[model samples]
Target: MSDSNTTDFTNPSTFILLGIPGLEAVHVWISIPFSVIYAIAVLGNLTILFIVKLEPSLHEPMYYFLCMLAITDLVLSTSTLPKILSIFWFNSREIDFNACLTQVYFIQCFAAIESGILAAMALDRYVAICHPLRHSTILTKPLVAKIGLAVLLRNGIVVMPYPFLLMRWSYCRTNIIPEPYCVHIAVVKLACSDTRVNSYYGLFVLFFVLGLDVIFIAISYMQILRAIFILPTKDARLKTFLTCGSHLCAIVIFYIPSVIYSLIYRFGQNFPQHVHVLLGNMHFLLPPMLNPIIYGMKTKQIRGRLLGLVTR
Candidate 1:
C-alpha cells in the first residue's frame, strides 16, 4: 500500500496535550506545585476515609456517606492528576488512544458518582433534620449501601457510552488537545467524523448527572429548611441549622463552579484559555480538599476521632 493508503487505513493512535497556556514555557516547573496539591488531595481524602472507617462511633448513615464521598474524591483526583503530571513534568503529552479513553471514562464516572453521593448526603441531612423520628427507619444500613452501589452503577452507565463513542471516530490530522487532562469534550473535538451524536449524548448526560443531581439536592435542602423553621424552640432551630451548615457549604463549593463553568463555556465563546484549565482543576480539586476540611472543622466528633486515632 502507498503512504497515503497506509495512513488512511487507521486513525492516529496518539494525541498531544497543550497544557495551561502561558505556563507551557515552564510546564516542568509548574508541575511541582500541581504534584504537591495532588499529593495533598489524595492523602487528605484517604485520611478522611480511614478516620471514618476506624471510628466505630462513625458507623452512622452520615459518616457512611462521608466515607463514600472521600472515596469518590480519591477517584476524581487520581483520574486527572497523573496524566497532568506526565504532560507537565515529563513532556510526555502523547497518550495512546486506549489510555485517553480510559482516562475520560474514569473522570466522567468519578464526577457523576460525586454528584450522586452529594445528593445522597443531602437526603440524609433532610431525613435527620426534617424527619428525626423516622431517620433510622428511612436511612438504614442496607439502604445506604444500596444507594452507594446505585451511585456507582448509575455513573458507570452514564459514562459507558463516552469511551465507546470515542473509539468510533477517525483522527484525520488534529491531535493536540488544549487542556491539562483528557476531558471528554477535548477528546471529541479531535475526531474527524461528525460529532453531533457524541455532543448530544454529552449534553444529555450532563443534564441528567449534574443538573438532576443538583436539583434533587436543592429540593431536599428546601424541605429540610421548611422543617427547621417550624421547630418551636429557638435552640432546636439553631442545632438543626448548625448540623446542616457544613453540608450546605460543601454543596455550594461543589456545584457552583460547575454551573458557572457550564455557563461560561456555553456563552462566553472567546473565554480566556487559562480560565478553562483553572476551572477544570478547581472543580476537581477544591471539593475533595474542602469536604474533609468542612467536616473536620464543623463536626467535633470527627475531630475528636481523628485526634484519638493519631494519639493512639
Candidate 2:
C-alpha cells in the first residue's frame, strides 16, 4: 500500500481505476459481455436514429424525443465504456485527472438529460392520449425544440460545477478508484478536504433533476391510463396502452438500476464492493443496450421501418 502522506496532496496527475475490485482475475472474461452489450447499444441506437431520420412519418414529437434520447445514450455510454474496456482488457487503469473530470461531467450530465427527455416524452404521451385533438398544436416543432433545449440547459448547468468543485479539492488520499468509471461521489470521496458541499450538491442534483422527472413521468402515465380506460372500446384502449409500452420500459430500465445503485452506494455498507460497482456500471449500461431494443420492438412505425431497412 502506498503512503498517502508521501503522495502529492493536490489533484494527482492521474487516478487509477481498479475495475470491479475483487474481480481482477476474470476481467478478460467480464469484458466479453460488456463488449457485446456496448456493440449492440451502438448498433441499435444508430439504427433508431437512421430509421427515424429516414421515415418522414416519424417526424413527430415522440420520435424527436426518442432521437434526443438516442443521442444522449450514445454520449453517456461512449463517455465511460471505452475507458472501462481499456481497464478490463489491458489492465490500463490510469485516467488523466482532467479526463476523469470530463468523464464525470458527461456521464452525469447526459444521465440527467436523459431523465428530462423521458419526462418530456411522458408529457407528449399525455397530450397525445388525453387531448388527442390538440396533440399536434401542443407539441409543435418550436415547442419540442424548446423542450429539448431546456433539458440540455438544465442538466448542463446542474452538472457543470462537478469538475470545478472537484478541482478545488485536495486528493491527499490514495488515487485508486474502485469502480471502472469516475462518478461525482466516487471522485469526491477521495478528497481529503471538506466535501460536504459536494455530497449535498450531488444529493440535490439527484432529487431535483431525477426525482422530479420520475414524479412527472408517473403523473403523466396515470393520466394516460385514465384516458385510455375511458375510451369505451377494448381495441382503442389496447392500442393506446401499447403506445406507451415502449417508453414505460425505457423508464423502468433506466430508473430502477439508477435508484438501486444510488441506494447501495449510500447505504449498503454491508454489501460487497463489487455489488456497488456493478450496480453503478449497470445503471449506465442497461439503458443504452435495452432502450433501442425496447423501442424497436414496441413502436410499430420504427419496427416497420427497421424491417424494411433489413429486407431492402
Candidate 3:
C-alpha cells in the first residue's frame, strides 16, 4: 500500500476497496448471503440457457430474447460477485488500477446491454400480443441477430471511453474506494483533476442509453396492454396478462433498485454511505438472482423443461 504522504499523484499502483464502509466488521457475515445469491444466480441462469438450447420447442423469438436476458444477467453478476466475495472472505481488497478500470467497463457495459435486452424483450411481447400474425415474419432469425449485434455495439461503443477517460486523470486524492467493486463514478471521483466531463458523460450515458430503453419499454407495454384489453374474452385478457407478468417482474427487479441507487448517489447527500453501497450492490445482484426464478415459475414451458431436467 502506498503511504498517504508519499503516494504518486500521476499514477497509482492499486486502489484499496473498503467493502462497504460502515459494515466492515460484518463483511464476513455479509459474504454468506452474497455467496448464496451468486451461486443461485449462476446456476439459475445457466439452467435457463441450457434448457433453451436443448429444447427444440423453445426455439422462438421470445425464447431467444429470454436467452439473451439470461446471458446478460450471468455476465452482469459474474463480473462483480466473485471479487466481492473475495473481498469479504479473504480480506483481499487491493485491486490493480488497470484491472479496476476493466471491472468498471464490464459492469457498466453489461448493465447497458441488459437494459437494451429488456427493451428488446418488451418489443417481443408487444409484437407477439399486438401483431400475433406477423410475429414470425417480423422477428425472424436474421433480424434477431441484427438486434443482438446492435445492442452489443451500442453499449460497447458508449462504455469503451470510460477507462480512457479515467486513465487521463491523476489520482492524487486517495485510492480508497468505499464499495466492494470498482464503479465508474466511485473511481472517477478519486481523480485530483477536473472531473466534470467524466461526470457529465456518465449522466449522458445513463439518460441516453438506460433512459431511452425505459421509455421504449414503457411504450411497448402500453401497446401490449391496449391490445390485451381489446380481446373479447376475459380468459384471453387474463392469459395475456399472465404471459407478461414475468417480464414485468424482471423489469421492476432490475430498474427499481438502479433508479433508487442513482437518485440517492446523486441527490441524497444526507443518506448513509452504507445505504448507497447496499443499494448499488443490490442493483446488480437481485435481478440476476430473482429473474430466473420469476421466469421459471411464470413460464410454463421453462417450468416443464426444468422438471424434466431434474427428473432425468
Candidate 4:
C-alpha cells in the first residue's frame, strides 16, 4: 500500500505477447492457419459433445468420458486462442496482468483436466476389456459422475493457485512476454521477485499432477495389453486392440509434445525461446483439433452416429 514498497507497476505492466517471438512481420498470415485450427477445434469438439449427449447409447461411461474430454478441449482452446488470434490478426498484443493471469489459470486448468480425463478413459477401457463382467457395474453412471467430479476438483485444487502465486510477484520488467500466449513459467520468469517457490512448486505439479497422470495412463495400457495378450481368441485380442487404439492415439498426440515442451521449459536453458513458444502452441492446438476426429473415425458407434447426424 505504501509508495515506498510499490514500484511503478503501470508503465509496462501490460504484457505484449510477442507471438511467435521474432515472426511478427506476417502475423496476419500466421493467423490464417491458427484461425482455421481454432475454428475446427471448437466446432468439432462441440459436435462430438452434442452427439454424445443426444444419443441414448452414448449415455454409457466411455461416451460420457468422451463428452468430458470434448468439453475440456473446447475450454482449453477457447481460453487462449482469442487473445492469440487478436495478437496475430489485429496486432492487439496488450493484455492486462490480471487478465493474463486468468488466461494462464484456465488454460492450465483445462489442460490438466484433459490429461486427467484421458487417464480416466484409459481406466474405463481397462475395466471394459480386462474385466468385462465387472465393467458395467464398476463404471456405472454414478461412478462416472464421481470420476468427472474428481477430475474437476483435482485439477482445480492443484492448478488454480499458481496464477495467484504469480500475481504475488513484482513484475517491473518490459511486461512483454515472449511466448505466443501467457505461459506459466514464461510469465513467472519476468517478475523481479524471487520465483524459487513458483519454480519448485511448478515442478512438483508437473511430476505429481500431470506427470503422474501420464504414468498412470501408461500403467493402465500395460495392464490392458497384458490382459489382451492372454485372451483365449485371436479375434478377441484384435478387437481389444481396436477398442483402445483411439485412446492410444489421443495420448500420444497430447503427451509427447507436452512432455518435450515442459522439459525444454525447465531444463533446456540453452534452447531458443521460439522453439519453446512453438511447442507450447502445438501442445494445446493439435490434440484438441484431432481428438474428436480420431474418435469419430475409430469408434464404430460414434462414427455411425456422427455420420447419421452429418447426413441429417
**Model 1 lDDT, full chain set:** 0.84
Q: Candidate 3 regions off by >4 Å?
A: 2-8
Score every model by TM-score: 0.93, 0.96, 0.97, 0.93
Error of 1 at 147 (Å): 0.7
CA deviation > 4 Å runs, candidate 2 = 1-8
Query: What tens-digit string does per-residue lDDT give for candidate 1 at 54-162?
Result: 8788889999999998888888888888888887877777777788899999888998898899899999999998888999999999999999999999999989999
Q: Which residue pairs of candidate 1 clash? A: none
How much RMSD separates candidate 2 from the native structure? 1.6
Question: What are the lDDT scores of the predictions, listed in order?
Answer: 0.84, 0.91, 0.92, 0.86
Enumerate residue pairs that collide in model 4: none
**Best-matching candidate per lDDT:** 3
lDDT tens string, model 3, 1-312?
853534555688899998998998999999999999999999999999999999999999888888988899999999999999999999899999999999999999999999999999998999999999999999998999899889999999999999999999998878888899999989987898999999899989989999999999999988988999999999999988888899999999989998889889989999999999999999999999999999999999999999998899
Tally clashing residue pairs in candidate 4.
0
Error of 1 at 174 (Å): 0.8
lDDT of 2 by residue, 1-312 (tens): 342335655668888889998899999999999999899999999999999899999999999999999999999889989998999999898888999999999999999999999999999999999999999999999999999999999999999999999999999877988899898888988899999998899889988999899899989988988888899899989988988889889999999898788788778999999888888999999999999999999888998998987899
Kindly give the number of clashing pairs for every candidate.
0, 0, 0, 0
As a TM-score, model 4 comes out at: 0.93
lDDT value, residue 39 of candidate 1? 80
The reply for model 4, stretches above 4 Å from the true place, is 1-13, 267-271
Deviation from native of the Cα of residue 96 in model 2, angstroms: 0.6
For every candidate, C-alpha RMSD to the true structure in Å: 3.1, 1.6, 1.3, 3.5
Q: Largest TM-score belongs to which candidate?
A: 3
